[model samples]
Target: MRLLHLGNVMMDLVLTVPALPERGGDVVATGSRSAPGGGFNVMAAAARQGLPVTYAGAHGSGPFGDRARAALREEGIDVLLAPRPERDTGFVVCLVDAEGERTFVTSPGAEATLRPTDLAQLRPEREDLVYLSGYGLLYEANRAALTAWVPQLDPAVTLIVDPGPLVRDIPADALQLLMARADWWSCNAREAALHTKIDDPAAAAGALRSRLKRGSALVRTGPDGCLLHHDGTLDVIPGFAVRPVDLNGAGDAHTGVFMAALAHGLAPAAAARRANAAAAMAVTVAGPATAPGADALDAFLRQSRPAPR
Candidate 1:
């Protein structure tokens, strides 16, 4: 199965501290690392899971772009970067605390310059799955292109949508339109609540499931676990307890693993379980794109005895 990930590919500079600092307070960072970001994290994780993955995005002609592409290549992800000579690659500065919570300061850079015409360059086969992140739809140009391209996609191609942390900024109608077109919808508890206007993650996920055209709704509830609504049933999957070093891209890892498992013919519940294990492993590392391979992930799953729903 070939997975096509569409969104920003960025260089992420992460600083890990023992604790998060208060407003206007100074703290020393204990660790620092650079990795990929946005949908690149997901694509890399999927590739690590042994999925055939292709990435579509814009990377500039700069040192950061070189690092980004190199990181992707190391993970064995096929890159389809837009050729832009004058722009610099996008990047973000992320601060992570001991508890794995993070704060991001971003510069869109070349990613912001992606135009509608770029969408025409993507030519995935009918069997490929397209995974789109919310950040891509946040910008007017990319959003317009996505809006125009979604309906034209081959019906055999599965579309998975992750609203990520930016769904609150999207118009309700646009959100609905994307939901209607998606084959699967995944979001964290906060994003799910914001999208459905429900404070409870499970209720919000259930509500969103009803609103979807032909897909299930999954809400990731941090350490408490995750809840999924599919085919008129709700399954509560427990999250594993791990000493997290960084939580920056855990969600992205989860989403990627879930999509990869699905592409490999796993049931939705089994895929969610696999993804949950992958995410548990991700938080144990320091970088945003630190996803475990299939062997490591399988061992983690074997040790994690998830609670029965």
Candidate 2:
């Protein structure tokens, strides 16, 4: 199965600090590295699952963009990038504290410059699943482009929407429209709460499931695992235990594996389980796109104890 991931490709500079410093105080970074971010990480996770995946995004003519492309290629993802001559590649500076919590400062950079016309250049064949992230919709240009293209999708093609950190400010009407068009909606607990104004994660997932025309709603609850609501049923999948060195890209890894499992024809519950396992493995590493290989992931799944009833 082929999956197409549409969103930003960023150069992530991750710094592991001993702890979060006080306001205006200095903190020494223990370690630092650069890796892929956003949709790039998702595509990497999917590719690591041995799926045929392609990434669509904007890249600049710079070293960072070159590094991003190389990183995707290393994961076996086909890169379909629109070139931005004037701007540099997008980047995120992530600061991870001792507890694995993170803070991010991002510049949309070249990704923000992508236009609707750029999407028209590529053709998504039938049976290709499309995966989109909320970060793409955070900007007006990409939002308008995605909004225009979503309605034109063929019913046979599945579309998965991951409302990452940026969906809170999206206009309600626009959010509703995108949800209506999506075949699957995935969000973390915080994002679901912010978007639906429902404090409880389960209730927020239910609200999202109810509001969408069709498709399942998945609420990712960090270490608690994920809650899925679809077709008047709810399934809760427990997370696997792992020593997390950095939690920055764990959610993106989960979303990516979820899409890959769906493309591989797994049921929603089974897909969530696979995704949770992948996420558990992701947090054990440090880089933003540090997903496990197929062999490692399979071993991890094999050894994982089942979730308690």
Candidate 3:
């Protein structure tokens, strides 16, 4: 089944500062650069794995939008949305501290213009997976649209949801419905804690699993690794030890590779394992959209995780 990515496209400007600035307290950025940040990061993860990927997110006609479009085309992703000239592409300024934690300030653009009308042309198959980003669920404009569209999807079609940082902001009704329909959910520990009201990572994962009914859930714990609960089975997918330079897109990388593995017919446990490795690789790089193809991931995994004595 092909994977369809649904979410925002962003030009994220990452500034490496000594620490996140306090109000009225300025700190000079030691380094900075713009790179693909949000939904496109997920698409990049799938595309790098040579999966058949489609981008249904909004693409604008602004400079950053142009770069986003070209980058998608460069990766051979089928762009499902045309460049909207009325609005510029969205951007986020991310401040990375010495410990690689990040703080973001955002401005909406064309990506936020995603209306329910935007999805009128989509035709999903049961074998295909429609991946939803949490921002789309939280954004008022897209939320109502998705509330109407999700129920209409053929029961045969699979759903993958990543309830990102805005999980707490998602309306209760919307979150309830999506959880009922979602086959897979990916998020970091904090998001899970907020959404599930469970402080423990493992407990949060279990709570989500219980809520999902027919679906599965994954909770990522940086350095500690990831937890996956699939089809009544649960496992702790180990992570690699790496000096993280940037935490951006790490969850997206996990989601993208996890879905890609499932699309390629790998079992849930195997898919989660691959995703863990992929996410471990993401933080090692500086850019938000950095993802390795199958070959590179395989090499890294084999070398970093040698057979036990």
In order of appearance, the predictions have TM-scores of: 0.90, 0.92, 0.93
Q: For model 2, how does the per-residue alpha-carbon lDDT over 1-309 read when each residue is reduced to its tens digit?
A: 688887888888888899988999999999988777767888888888888998776788788888887887787788776568787888999888887788989987887766778788767787788988888888788888888888888888888988876787776677888888888999999999988899899999999999889888999999879999977998889998888886767888898888888888899999999899888899999666777877998899988864554
lDDT of 1: 0.83
Question: Lowest-lDDT window of 10 residues in candidate 3?
Answer: 300-309
Candidate 1 residue lDDT tens string, 20-84: 77899999999998877777889988998889998777678889888888888888888876557
lDDT on C-alpha atoms for all candidate structures:
0.83, 0.84, 0.84
Off by over 4 Å in 1: 16-31, 96-101, 307-309
Candidate scoring better on TM-score of 1 and 2 = 2
lDDT of candidate 3 at residue 201, scale 0 to 100:
93
RMSD of 3: 2.1
Which 10-residue window of candidate 2 scores lowest in summed lDDT? 300-309
- Give a tens-digit lDDT track for model 3, residues 42-154: 98898888788888877788799988888888888898878888888989988888887778898888887776777887888889989998887766777887888989989
